[model samples]
Target: METLYRKYRPKRFSEIVGQKHVKTLFINSIKNNNVSHAYIFAGPRGTGKTTIARILSKSLNCENRKDAEPCNVCNSCISIDKGNFMDVLEIDAASNRGIDEIRKIRETVGYHTAQGKYKVYIIDEAHMLTREAFNALLKTLEEPPSNVVFILATTNPEKIPQTIISRCQVIDFKNIPLKDIVDRLEFVCQKEKFNATKDALIEIAKRANGGLRDALTILEQVAKSSKNNIDINDVRNTLGLVSEELIDNLLKNIKEGNIINILKIIDEVYYSGRDFETFLFQTIEKILLLIEENNNTEFINLLKPLSDILKDIKYSEEKIILVKLGFLNLINFKENNNKTTNKVLENIKKESEKIEENIESEKTEVMEKDIPKFDEVLEDLKINGDLSLYIGLSFAKIQEGSDKIKLIFPYSKKLHFELIKDKKSFLEQYIKRKFGITKEIEVILSNSTEDETLKKLSFLFGKNYKIEGD
Candidate 1:
């Protein structure tokens, strides 16, 4: 059976979705009998760049086309739809990205169309063209033959040469919106005679991330996998995405500051063999909704770290642990922030007491660097919703100071130290919250350099290794 994406591909302009502007331009050009010789269609994949190009090709060549719409029954339209048209050439630039392939086009530029007035060349993945290949095509694009029209379609328009882009009219295609995708899925389900729930289609639409072709492909897969009525669970299972209930529970737990509940959800996600990246994204989407409703930055802050974790999920062995750590970091952030608020109030009381107490007495408490507080400060940082800072501070060592909290790191840890150091003011505020007294915050690289052998040993054995000579 043909794939739904190909089987139900948009053959006409009216069938395309979410890019009314591009369609408007094409319709107007067709009405005026004026079409550009060279054009570039740029946007995300499955947004119908090549599909629109084919429709244009069919309309321009259609013997009985009206108002830029092709008659499906006509020989020209049927041949073009089947990819056997003599005048319409579809080139995959990815495989044939060298100058030699483009040379074929340069050689054929002057020839009259075999079957139609306009010969359309639709080059997909145009961005993959080699720099030399683009150089070869530059002249052809700038001054193409009168009868030929070039439609360059690319997901990445930036890679295409400026000179090539300058000569061609550029039309950007947008990813079809979720509602449109859901509607399209419904249409597909009705035509295929498959039983589908609205929620199922919605889930597929959400999973597609604005790609209508992706949505149809998913729907087709789900329909094949489930012989019975297709529902949201089947869609969820097929996509390995968390359900709405789980997402709701996650946000509720996060808002209530229930770390245990949040961890439980994370554990459920892991045990269910769910895609952590997808789960993370779903969770973040819920968080964003909460932020929109409640205007909470706390949840908003988690997005950055979660996004970073998603980037690294493929590279890490323990992705579940990374996600757990991310949320734990958020929990720690909320806990430490609440602690900071209380400590600031306590610090005010302490300050007033210092005014009444002797200077030496104040020094005994305020000036004394509590070693345990350094761990607390780092813990607070780890939990404080700043994943980058948490990752950075993980590399530094806390040092003793009578009048200041000193953070020392080996030269190798300079990057981490710098990351934490960038948030010096926030660190000071955290210190004041934890210790009820603000101390000078100092970050410095170690003055003593370890021998190369010792450094290697330390790296291999971790920081627990004891140096006999040192």
Candidate 2:
């Protein structure tokens, strides 16, 4: 019996799945009667390279082609579909990649068509052709036969010589979009009257990773294994993949610092024979989505630890231990950050009070009239949702100048200075909001040898008060 992918392979341009761009080029070319002599179809596996090549062959020789689509009922289309067409030839370059094969093709392209308007050579896996064979075919590709069409399809276009590439119109076939793959699977199920949950179809599509043909193959395998009532659980069981729900639970516990639940989940995954790398990768992907799309920094602390764990996996066979250590590092880092924030907040509060006290006692003309207190800057950062920036800025001191407000970072904190320098516009905006006009702010890395910086910062509080903290 024929497989589902082969049985439902696109017979016409309209039935070809994704890659709107590729379809447009051929459609426009056919409409204007200006088809090229040689074309290169390049991209990933199972992504409609050979499929589109065959469709283009059929369209070129199609007796009643309309709007770049072959009339499937015509004798020319039928012979091409049956692989019996005299003028349309499909060669598997992987097997026939030699000078002999190129010699035959060079001889064949020079002849007149036996039955069709043009002779089409569809070469699948064109990259596998030997270098000498490519050199022999280069002249034919360069000075294309007026009546011949050469379609070179390959998964790796880089292997094909540039001389061959420059002679052809290169059309890249991309991975079919997930939604399109699912829609195609749904249509297949509806046609076959096979029952499947939408979640099951989606899971199949995700695992296919943008390959429509591979998605159909997976769907067919699952359908064969099931009693026509396939659901999400059926997919998980058959594919031996980690459960999405279980991964979510693991992430939730990690974020809440629930070390016990995290251990249970890790143990369950390890003992049940699921892949640790797969589970880790899926969990990391979920966290990345949260950070990128939602801007949720709850698990941002784990990125470094998780990255280290991933690197450690390559060197050590003790993956489970490394994974556990990585998760433990997450909570430890989170708690340490909380401690650091508390310490910084405490020091800022104390410093603000002391500066206010000295201002009332001595009536300092500089700080009381010019810039905001340090605590006020920290408060604005907290209220405005710039946690990482706030933390980066916490290491530095704000220096009020006659022409500019300089953010001074001690030489030891040059990394923080570099990180915070990207937000120069935001700091300038803060200065403008506080002082009623825009002011330039410069990030200055102070010399570490310059007497500890505690004395140089006396302009903020008073000549008597010299404050510093890491």
**lDDT for every model?**
0.83, 0.82
Q: Which segments of candidate 1 are over 4 A away from where they belong?
A: 252-263, 293-298, 345-470
All candidates: TM-score: 0.71, 0.70
Q: Give the Å shift of residue 370 in candidate 2.
A: 24
**lDDT tens digits, residues 1-470, model 2?**
99999999999878889999998888899889899999999998888988888888888888898889999989999998889999988889999999999999888788888999889889999999999999999998888678899999999999999899999999998988889999999999999888999999999998898898889888888888897778988887777778878988987887677999998998998898877776777777778988999999877766677777777776788889988887788778887888899998887787677656644543342224335654566677878758877877766667766667677776656788898898989877875787565667788888764332442355334567634667
Clash-forming residue pairs, model 1: 332-383, 333-383, 333-384
Tens-digit lDDT track of model 1 for 118-176: 89999999999999999999999888888889999999999888899999999988878
Misplaced by over 4 Å in model 2 are 94-100, 301-322, 325-350, 363-470
Number of colliding residue pairs in each model: 3, 0
Measured on C-alpha atoms, candidate 1 has an lDDT of 0.83
